[model samples]
Target chain A: MLKLDREIRDAIVAHAKRDHPDEACGIVAGPEGSDTAARLVEMVNAAGSPTFYEFDSTELLRLYREMDDNDEEPVVVYHSHTATEAYPSRTDTDLAQEPNAHYVLVSTREHGNSAGPVEFRSYRIVDGVVTEEDVTIQE
Target chain B: MAIEVRIPTILRTYTDGQKSVEASGSTLQQIVDDLEANHSGIKERLVEDSGELRRFVNVYVNDEDVRFTGGLETELSDGDQVVILPAVAGGC
Candidate 1:
């Protein structure tokens, strides 16, 4: 199970909503090897395509260097699905590089918090396989 | 001459299951060619017969995606960290 703070979860949801048509992507950093996601780093979607998302390479470089300097690593790598369910696509499963990080997906298809709750899910993708896991939001 | 190339799980087979390996080059293409010399068949997975990066392969140098840096022609240097990932897609 992935233990996420409610505030962090809400913040991620808000980001997803903010980029409704374009997928929002970011990472939560934690102490190296600790697996605790504590810092949120929002990234620009270079593609800015409703159907695709790519992190700005320069920003990614900066983030990685910052994490390295701070003795941290990405613990939660997340992206939103504007029109799909919260599940890893084949490409997602294939792209997952951090076996230790939780891959979070938030679907904004409904695109409304007032209408109904959004689909938020987490997964462990390792070696081309994707396994859906539980997400516990701490109050 | 030794630049650390981080390997994703799916591509670990080409690197004897190791998560990272060393390659040398002044540009990204040369480095991949160097990788192929040690770990065969990897070049095919990353590049197409058309010499273009396979549609799904995403290569990065020091956390910067190569697409914006010149694709396979991206330059490299000592101690640079190269990462390769597949392009993930999500939508209904």
Candidate 2:
């Protein structure tokens, strides 16, 4: 199971709505080894395709460096699935390198650019296998 | 061998359950080769016999995907972090 702050969850939903049609991807960084996500770092989708998502390489590098300097690690790696369910696709599971991080998928298929019932789910992708986990929103 | 290569859980078996290892290389390919020398079986999983990155594998140099930077030719600096992971779908 993964625990996310209500604010972080709302922000993720906002990002998904903001990038409707095209997928949005980002990470939430937390103190290294803490397993608690604290900071939100929204990223540009390099692919910019509704069917695909990739992080902007240069921005990703800078974010990683910043996290390192602050003794942080990506605790929650998230992306929006504009037209699909809140689940990890083959591509998403393939790119899940951080075994310790929670992989969150939000489906904007219902809301699109507006606000409605968004499906936000979490998973643990290890070695190409995705195991869905419950998400607890902390107020 | 100042570069730190972070091995994913599936690949940890090759590194004797190690999460991260240190190796040296000026380029991404060399670093992978060095990793192969120390941890066998990882190279085959990451790189194809055609000498290209496997379709399912994603190699990131300092959090930047190597395919975008320069593939196996991406330059590396000391203390850089190399991460290797499988490529799976993100949505249903």
Best by TM-score: 2
* TM-scores for every predicted model: 0.76, 0.79
True contacts kept of each: 0.28, 0.33
Per-residue lDDT over A49-136 for candidate 2, one digit per residue giving the tens place of the 0 to 100 score? 8988777555655776688689898899999998889888776776677788899999999979986989999999877888999999
Candidate 1 per-residue lDDT over residues B1-92, each given as its tens digit: 78898776568889998978999998898998999999999999899999998866778887777888999998888889898765433333
Off by over 4 Å in 2: B1-28, B54-92
Angstrom error of the Cα, residue A20, model 1: value is 1.5
Q: Candidate 2, DockQ to 2 decimals?
A: 0.33
Cα lDDT, model 1, residue A19: 82
Candidate number achieving the greatest DockQ relative to the actual structure: 2
lDDT score, residue A136, model 1?
A: 92
True contacts kept of 1: 0.28
Q: Which candidate comes out best when scored by lDDT?
A: 2
lDDT of 1 at B30: 93
**Would you give the TM-score of chain B in model 2?**
0.92
Candidate 1 local lDDT, A29-124, one digit each (tens): 999878788999888888887667767656656776688789898889899888788888776776666777899998988854333578999999
Residue-wise lDDT of candidate 2 within B14-69, one digit each (tens)?
99988689989999999989999998888998888999988657778877788889
